[model samples]
Target: MENWEAGWDDGEVGESSFDYSNHTKSQFLDDVERRLKLFMVRCVKVCRTLPGSYDGQHFGQQLIRSSSSAAANFRAVRRGRSQKEYFAKLSVTIEELDESLFWLETLVSTDLMPEHRLADLIDEGYQLLKILSKSRKTASD
Candidate 1:
């Protein structure tokens, strides 16, 4: 099992375990960045388990591309040149994550992979999406 998958089993990434109440902005962002990176790695690992068929290859490639892009853009957000740059990068990161979620859903909807196998990753994707969206909204305000 991947680290993120293990995370779910261990209750490390569960909703109750995701507390950031006592964290400073920098600490929260840093933690998010680490999670994003791990998410990318987990996606790649999942893709590797996909069948080598046409649909599998297609969705897997798209999944890897979007998840990796999301991670990279989020990293850029951390080093953003200004507020405008930060918002722009964050927007791209959100967009990429949305795409990643789509690909993941497609994989399961088309019966490429079992839904149960991907439930944790899909949950994590949505969780990350929510976290980033709230962060962007908070920053904008």
Candidate 2:
């Protein structure tokens, strides 16, 4: 038996077990979820420091939606029943990730967020985009 299969419950083994490397997928998704949560936390911190004004509200909402959507769409992609569905869901994930990055850039450029503080989260967002793009391409083929 494979090293991975050795730890599994005998009764739980099935075709799906062989079809997907759950360990790998779970690890990747966990990383994605972690980054998304971190992004949201940073957004909240920046938003709190901003003046009570319309710009703050608008920017906060955009950041909240995009950051949250990344994880939501990633979950949807994992649950997809077909390759087509998976790619479609991943496309949304990519879009949301990009949108989050855009908002982060805007925040920095507009001086709402410090560039030094936003650097790490922005890097994470770019990495996620690269990962999602690769996944989407693979699913499409």
Candidate 3:
């Protein structure tokens, strides 16, 4: 079995306690990595749908850069050897996620993409912003 699944035999995921705080370190890391991957995929798909014009190309590249950084910087967060370092790297994810939301809003405003196309992604970015913000607050507290 994969590393994240290896601890299932220990009742790591019983129904009584199914929250993220209950997970092992590896499981948590894997969860973050999985989320980043999925977010990046969403970015790629949305960027590809942009119209073939100057604004489309500009926002597409901006979206790709921010979304990709959010995921890639997560790896850096995982590598952090100290609380300060971790928070520093994690902050990058927070900023990039927010930047992504801005770009998505821009696309919708310009009528370059339909609102339905970005609704889920917009919501996800908002959710992630809340999550990451809470995490950083907790870390420093």
Best candidate according to lDDT? 1
Please state every model's RMSD to the true fold in angstroms: 6.9, 9.4, 6.7
Q: Which residue pairs collide in model 1, if any?
A: none
Better of 1 and 3 by lDDT: 1
Error of 3 at 64 (Å): 0.2
Task: Summing lDDT over every window of 10 consecutive residues in candidate 3, give the lowest-scoring window.
Answer: 1-10
Question: Across residues 26-115, which tens digit of lDDT does each residue of candidate 3 receive?
Answer: 776777677776888898899998888999999999999998999898888778888789889988888998898899999999999999
Off by over 4 Å in 2: 1-23
Worst 10 residues of 1 by lDDT: 1-10
Model 3: lDDT equals 0.75
lDDT for each residue of candidate 2 in 1-141, tens digit (9 for 90 to 100) = 321122232323322222224556566566555656676677667666765677767887888788788778877876888767877887888898899889889888878778998887777676656655655655555
Q: Measure candidate 1: CA RMSD.
A: 6.9
| Candidate 3, residue 121: lDDT | 77
**Which residue window of length 10 is worst by lDDT in model 2?**
2-11
Quickly count the clashes in candidate 1: 0
Identify the candidate with maximal TM-score: 1
lDDT of 1 by residue, 31-134 (tens): 88898999899999999999999989999999999999999999998898887888899889999999999999999999998999999889988888877776
